[model samples]
Target: MFTIVLISCFALYFINDKEYQQTAWIVLIGTVFTWTLISYWIRLQESELYNRINLRVVNYIKIYILLIGFVIAFYTFLPFSVETKNIVAAIVLGFPILGIPVNLLVVNTIDHLRSSNSNTKYTLVAGVGDMAGTVEKHLLRHNGSHVKLKGFIKCKKEECIVGEDRVVGDLDHINDYLRNNPVDEIVIAIPVKVSKKIQSIITAADYHGVRVKYIPDYRGLFGENYKVTRYGELDAINVRQLPLDETYAFFLKNTFDKVFSAFALLALSPLIVVLAILIKLDSPGPVFYCPIRIGKGGRPFKVFKFRSMRENDASTGGTKSTQKDDPRITKLGRILRKYSLDELPQFMNVLLGDMSVVGPRPHRSFLNQKLQESVDKYMIRHYFKPGITGWAQVNGWRGPTETDEQRKQRTMHDLWYMEKWSLWLDIRIIYKTIFSRKTHKSAY
Candidate 1:
């Protein structure tokens, strides 16, 4: 609708009559206003995650109807000549006639291409019985190219029909397997009667920040809060589905991350150059420091930052946290660290898709392991990409994790942010990161 009205206004620019132009402006404003409301009500901007082609088409049709009706009715009341109205209306109404179908076709084509591409989920099955095999078959049939079933975890006394080489380990060792692997999700295919075993697996999943899903054998097995989504014809319940788990939410955040990082880097390029020169002249080391940090899915990636400390073992991967009077920090480095100017280079990490604009701050490997052992569900923070500044950082929980209290509090704040995440929450975090004194309370 906006496109139609915008094109009409542009075309009206060449017309000599001011009256026609005025009418065009009014129509554009009216169409935009109507669409703003309609889109909000229908959540037209949200990505549709329908796995079924028919369901996607049905949704597209419903949206098309609402849009077509609004365009036709909106143009009818305009004071323009009948010929003008007809031409404008035809152009507006005629668009979706071909546009919507083409859009669907293109979307499906992209999906097909993506299925064979790198966004694949590394999955693990938690049983080796009939149900487990059935679940595997369904996943293969529906998302064969997208979901890579790494292996299966066998249950005690369960008959194993799958090949012996395919079994990674048994249920008792699921935690060890998860800790050493990059698993995205664990699908429990065992019977609901094995509640204790299921709880153990769920606990391991929580500790490792891997998603847990159940192939439901009973309707009331899962709680009301658990989301029951279709896996082809089968029903699967996501035990703890965060908003970020949705396809649209992922797309929205990822898109924003890329755009925001690109813009920030471009706008701050001059400042970055100055800082780079200052760092080089201030110290005898490199301008930028790339430290190994654990990112999404527990994958290790080098986090980019201005070198805030002397080049040493600690500068890259040492477990020691910076202290207030640490001699390792240079003069200019101290000021940079105090105000977080050192973190500007991490926008490059965000641009490279290794991080987010707002998330739990990434930690060193030793710190990550220690926290996983001491803090409950600490690894849950790693479920999403790390950020340059995060909810914890903005809430005054940004410093050393020497105490159990600090570790727990930081993890809790991160989990809270994950549960309550939205584009608005991210914006608020960014605002506080820039202006709030508490955000810098722990900076040294």
Candidate 2:
């Protein structure tokens, strides 16, 4: 929808640009290449392997368009007799910059629909022990999550308990069970030595149109090297490592961080002053609170916040995250922290390149050291810049780290956010932070 609208709007703009006809250079390029680009994008969807790469190529095109927009706008102020109209026409094409991701999403949805309709449903072996447990979990976690089982071809003679259902029969009854039920997948959970005996059972299921999935005694369905793949059809999204790390994604992200942070600091200067006054009148403290925090790569930096705690005149202590009923918290501090008004000043941190508008939230040095010692994969989060707000805060993990479980989950969320970082993703997190009431929760 956005694509067609943009193309039409740009075309219309070019047709009307008689005064600045020289600016037609941009419009001419867009009009001539638009259909070609659309064709190539559709071709990418027809194949499975080229889909992701092609989508990224499309992203690069959008980035180029942004650069083109800036250049065209810059040249517009120049004394262009006819060249100005052409430039304006070219700039119009950039209006639908958001269409790139939208189009890819639509294509992915269609692909998922096709993959779901494919024959040969996955089968499972409902048995006893860790192998069985792994197989069952994978089966349940599979895209459809409704794959039919032939029966528990139990390696041991005892019946297995699974979600109030018991194994009614064994490998011997596999034939009989399929005769009476719909079973098209064979997920073998038997040990390798015992697997030889179940080979015929797997063959039987395969002969009967069932796709076989072996539950390895090792670990993970597709290995521990994570790969996050999604099929839009069944809404199945797996947390996995991507083979393609996007340089363009990084470019777009840093560009957005710098651009938006600068713009926000400038645009919100007035609001900052108003909040500064409120803080001064409502309590005794400095307008801005500078807290020591760990930034990207374990570097130390001072994070900016609207002062949300009493400036203790005689108190002496190392860094500490806020907790409920802290004596140093003023009435205004409570309000500011509750609504996250205290975080506004971090835009300066973002501008200074010490933080991102969206990423893992930075921790006080004390909390950072404590968490690093207790949590696995904790330090991995420092690979990316910290943010004013983060995934954990939005997901109800914000407050004080009172419990080990709370801190563990929060750290896990921070790692997850880093692993899944992307420009569109950052934008989504920002949207949630700005609009979601969950972010306003107050806890120690």
Candidate 3:
């Protein structure tokens, strides 16, 4: 809707050739706003992840529209030259897009902290809906999150939580419980079910004279993804399904994986050869370690890395990740692994379509098996090919996860990267990797 409105506005506002030519960039911005709104609307139809992004994008559209309007008016009234126009265009174009969400995310977090006590409160998940689970996860922001414990309220007898949170009671008398107990808000969470049952629940909330708000459920929707929408001005939400699989995101990541991996392999061939020779002399193993790793969709393939362990190192087992003083490390291997040079040859894996340049690092068979059992959404990382270096690795998750918390944090970062994956982000990560490097004291 914003898209067509933008086009009509541009067409009507800038009719003459000279005027249109002068205002082309500003009007072109309207095209972006159009697409922004449309894409959000589209993603709203599919993935729950995109819905949040769509909201951010829509908010940006508002800001962009206002800025564009001001600039256009400035150009028209001030009679600025084309050079001035170009400067304005560049400045307008350079509005920090990715940073906007990051900023809002920070601001929202700070605001939340200011308004609410830092004390951890026990949250009651209501209605067994998407919003509830989302709220539950959001409430569990960090291991040290403010909301201390979590409980649930079941709307149906069949609905139950598998996690540690205890079910408190039914929502029918939820208001009384809230009044008596120090319970937080009774968040009305409904899944993607547009039925009379949902309508009746909304009516009940209204008749009760209590404040009720719902977040849409995104899981298990028929379409590719899920989105949250206001539910008929009542304290309910509509879960709209959308095309979930992001073809563009997948394509962009894959392209980078292939292109950069191939380039690194070809360009660094001499360095790899030197490393191989060093490995042969220093260690009693093959020049390279070809460990079988699980890739996208549970496909198994040998991942190439400059050999970073002794020949007798266990290839298959449920072993904790190596630390700074791992005995398994050979003399040369220690140096190689320290600078992440041992991971260099995984460029071959990337070229083979077994991995990506930027993604969740692939786990060994033993670890994957262990984690799939432990982490709730562990295997979702396999939705895309594992990366030679990933969001986890660069962001200080380079070494083994000895603690459950470390593993969970690593997995969460990987998932966030997947949820908000973008080509530009990948490039930024790659840039950071090359410059910042994942050099940590913990990395053995």
Backbone atom clashes (below 3 Å) for every candidate: 0, 19, 11
Q: Candidate 2: lDDT over CA atoms?
A: 0.67
Error of 1 at 380 (Å): 1.5
Q: Residues 75-145, candidate 3: write the lDDT tens digits.
A: 78877577656645555555544435554575457545743664445455566654566677665543234
Instruction: Kindly indicate the candidate among 2 and 3 with the higher lDDT.
Output: 2
Per-residue lDDT tens digits of candidate 2, residues 70-167? 45764667564455554445454553455565676665665455356364354556456566766666554443322444346666543354543546
Top-TM-score structure, candidate number: 1
RMSD vs true structure, all candidates: 17.6, 13.1, 13.7
Q: How high is the CA lDDT of each candidate model?
A: 0.81, 0.67, 0.64
Model 1, 1-444: lDDT tens per residue? 445555566678788888776766666666567656765677655544334566556655676677678657656665667755765566556656664666567667766766774777899999887778888888776563667899999988778888888899998888899989889999998866564588888899999999989876543364333677888999777877788998999999999999999999999999999999999999898888887889998999998899988865564458678887888889998889888999999998988889999999999888889899999888878889998899999999997889878988999999999988999999999999999999998997
What's the lDDT for candidate 3?
0.64
Per-prediction TM-score to the true structure, in the order listed: 0.55, 0.50, 0.51
Residue 245's lDDT in candidate 2: 40
What is the alpha-carbon RMSD of candidate 3 to the true structure? 13.7
Model 1 lDDT-worst window of ten: 216-225
